[model samples]
Target chain A: MAEASDEQLMLAYRDGDAGAFETLYARHRARLFRFVLRSIKSRASAEELYQDVWMRVIEARATYKPSARFTTWLYTIAHHRMVDHWRRAGLSVVSLDTVDPPAGDPGPQRHAEAREVLTRFAAALETLPPAQREAFLLHEEAGLTAAEIAAATGSNEEAAKSRLRYALAKLKSAVDDG
Target chain B: MADERDPKVSRRYRELGNEEPPPGLDESIVSAARRAAEHPHAPLVTPSGRHRWYFSLGAAAVIVLAVAVTYQMQQEQPDPFATGVSREAVKSPANGRARESAPPAADSSATARPEAATQAETSGRQGAAAPEARMRRDEAAARSLAKPMQAPAVETPQRMLERIVELRKQGKHEEAGQLLAEFKQRYPGYRIPENVVRP
Candidate 1:
């Protein structure tokens, strides 16, 4: 249940407990989906890659090990799948044009000013390079540390740190301009 | 790790993060996971499932190799009893034609003139038929193989039983009993009457 760690749940799934997999999926689904959604920036392609990541998890459950943090491995698979998607789609630059902004209302009756800032946040995210945005999302969404991000994305820790710094700086600048 | 006091940026990221994926996509993803867990070894409907064919291919290769080995051993030494061909004729082709024309069956005491028949006496193949039995077998084989259009029917166990019964009735109980013993050893699977076997 809630007391079990992600690794424990995954190990249980590996031993053929389907409920354990459902628990793991429920725990991480939102953050993982957001990671893929914001990384790819296209609802259609994001869903495609999102489903693919989970399928990879289920397929690899039998071989699951405790070698690394579960989140680290999950994000790593996500990162690699994104890389493959981009490679196949001819290296199209990751841009804000990928995900359409929310149509009319800023959700849940937040103040107009905060809504504008959130919109700017989404736009700024799309503007950043895919690598930078991914590092930021891995930190904020998956709650991975800089070292974990580097492990997931196959970059040095400093590089992951730099991307997060650049991403946060750009988003701050976008908000300040507003 | 930078600006710990930046509530505004953190708050804004949380707001955008609230943008949940569509419920339909969530349903599809979870359903797919359940399906995968249900059948871990089944290839997926996706592109990855194609890899399972390697298992089937390996099984097929083992089957083919086993069949090939069995067939080769059979060809190297066919069943002489089953084929009605003399072992000497099979082993020595130079004497094959002579064996083919000989009437050993017409006179079991006088075997075929094929040189291989003479060599049968000295041939040291273990488990081979005894010399006298082998000569009579050559005649039985010739009668069966050379006159295939009217090949004499092979002796049935019942016919052997009847002959043994006659021998017993003729006061040659030892010979009849010995032959009965041989018949019982050869036809263990046959359900013969115990009274007839002993009598």
Candidate 2:
């Protein structure tokens, strides 16, 4: 069969096609797991939440809609789940200090200086307000446009733009000052 | 100050953004998705239908028990003052010999109809409380029934797709598209061909 679109795959899964779900999961899983891992800062929690998110998708299969990009919807679910987890755990909304970039493989040549800079970058990300950080990640990491980010986050275009701008400024400052 | 800033900073930040996530993440996610698929009917993030059923059944049982108890109590006790004879009088010897043998205090007590009336009024007040309890039971039943019986309609691919179309028309195309993709993946058999998505 021809490769299906994300929406098509979701529709297929809804109709009891397990292969479609596997396709969808294969396509978006890494990015989503990384997204959650970055936000929550715990591998175990990320794994648990990751499982929870997919389970939600499975449960929601019957009602899956083609209204948004599958990835966006998936991320939104992940976002909400992460927020709920944080609330239940009595943790504050992610702070700026906890945002780390994807971990690099350990190597002698990967200088301590680069690691320090990346660590600072992560911290700066954690410090951003949830909206700003989400906007920045969607734009910078996911390659979404400001308008797209706004739609995913349920914010207006202007607000999304403002968040991106703020996130960039903060990140720049953190790198420069460090 | 702005002119002094290095353009490389932005470039470097952007470059760092694209770094691939750790290996095995995708496999882990796929595993999770597989696990989820295996147990499709697990309870939702919110309460499940079974929980609601249990609640409804429990409420019904309580109401039935309360009503039965009330009926039994009503049947066991007859109206006191209206009968014009003390329960004690009926319980005593059937002949006039018992009355003749009864003390004057007993006769005075039997004549106190007002007190008996007051006691009956209190019983009526107690009965009146039952309706309020019954009303509460009814309300609980209504509430249990008020919740939608099945999973919300929004969970369906068609509904989600419709919502996406609406959002798209409203210039929320990104979100609309995202939801559409998610829905499509979840329900692969229900393809809304790209051409017909808008119409």
Q: What clash count goes with each model?
A: 0, 44
Top candidate (TM-score): 1
Residue A123 miss distance in model 2 (angstroms): 2.0
Query: Which DockQ-derived CAPRI band holds candidate 1?
Result: incorrect
TM-score of each: 0.54, 0.50
* Candidate of highest lDDT: 1
Question: What is the Cα-based TM-score of model 2?
Answer: 0.50
DockQ of 1: 0.21
Candidate 2 on A25-103: residue-level lDDT in tens? 7677666655665566565676788777877787788888989887777767776797688787733323334434435
Q: Which residue runs of candidate 2 sit more than 4 Å off their true CA positions? A: A90-110, A176-178, B1-199
In lDDT terms, how accurate is model 2? 0.60
Per-candidate DockQ values are 0.21, 0.09
* Model 2 C-alpha lDDT per residue in residues B1-199, reported as the tens digit of each score: 1122235445544434532434565555455555555666644343457787887899999999999999986664432322333334433324322433443122212334444345445655677534434443343234334432322112345555655767777887665665666666667788685632653
Q: Cα miss at A51, model 2 (Å)?
A: 2.1
